[model samples]
Target: MFICPYCARNFYRAPKFRAVSHIRFLNASPNSPAIDVYLNDRLMFRNLLYKYFSDYVTIPSGTYHIKVFPSGNTVNPLIDKSLFIPPEKIFTLAAINEYPNMDLLSIEDVRHPKIPDKAFIRFGHLSPEAPTLNVVLPNGNTLFSNVSYKQITPYIPVDPGTYTIEARSSSSDERILYVPNIRLRGDRFYTIYAVGNLSKPPELQVLIPLDGNSYIGS
Candidate 1:
């Protein structure tokens, strides 16, 4: 069920549930506070903290004005942008970077007609102050190479299993952090997001969230 932001009416989807699109919000800003997300002046999500993802929401396809403000303060918006949504599409919109220089990143979630036997995953660099980094496997093979802040890598398929993925300095091969024993199932999509600050508290960490393309409308 969803309330139309434009009409302020509560309604359920009928036969054409897939006729609408889906979207989820991700907060990736390292030094930012909890935020309020408004679409066309209607609050859609509130108090979304850093490094967290909101549940998927169904919305009719159209252009929308996205206004992001610090929680409880609507006087000034950190970001005001117009985004278009086509029917039957799913997207993850992420807020990246610190205030005054933040950006909205739209990552499309493509629903495959047939699910593969292997798991599909991608990596993102969201640490604002981290140097160019590499996502490497235990064998030292880099899954993603030299990714800078705000960069998102293409998805790759891997065998379903538990593994420790590491973030290393690209030039020095110095280990930054490691995420251990991520159990991924077959026929799913995921994004391994590296966020937070390298120089301060809230130190760098990874976020592995099952993507909507894997289970939405199933």
Candidate 2:
């Protein structure tokens, strides 16, 4: 068991965990309760979240491709099976629903370098029925002021580099949404679409190949 240095809480395992797939689902209403869960065409758990209306599945340690679909919703399933991974250690999966009041959408210009000659940023969300978009640069500066939106925006732009974007209710008191660890690169454009809610937090994914090769970063 390990204890959190900050929270002083004991954990059965350390933070350096491995391949165990954790799956979660929320708001299991009649239309979507105990939905069917799958890991790469294999049925691992069924109605996993039916009784408590919330479900979680822990798969054996390894890498896996995951797929999620509603019971008998073959015509129009909710989640498509994608990549699911379980490292050599243990990890917990927590699934929750989106706060209907807000949805977050943002993307950076992918083709251009981190900083382009001309940049355009795009952000979108659904909630507070029309709120202002607030963008803060890594330098602790404001690029765009409180710009109100008519509908969910498609995108916006900044000078370049890293930044944080948030949605504030018209009054700027309540935070509607937040997007962090957003790194704008000169290579490709990044776009995010949050439906109902985000399946997972925005991730800074790094793909490393198994082939024996050394990577030297700047």
Q: What's the CA RMSD for each of the models?
A: 6.0, 13.5
Cα error, residue 122 of model 2, in Å, equals 0.5
Candidate 1: Cα lDDT at 151: 82
Winning model by TM-score? 1
- Cα lDDT tens digits, model 1, 5-105, are 11112223425644688888888887789999998998988899887777778888889899999999897798899999898888889998866577898
Model 1 weakest lDDT span, ten residues long: 1-10
Q: TM-score of every model?
A: 0.87, 0.32
The number of the candidate with the highest lDDT is 1
Query: In model 1, how large is the Cα lDDT of residue 202?
Result: 71
lDDT over C-alpha atoms for residue 44 of model 1: 86
Which residue pairs in candidate 1 collide? Answer: none
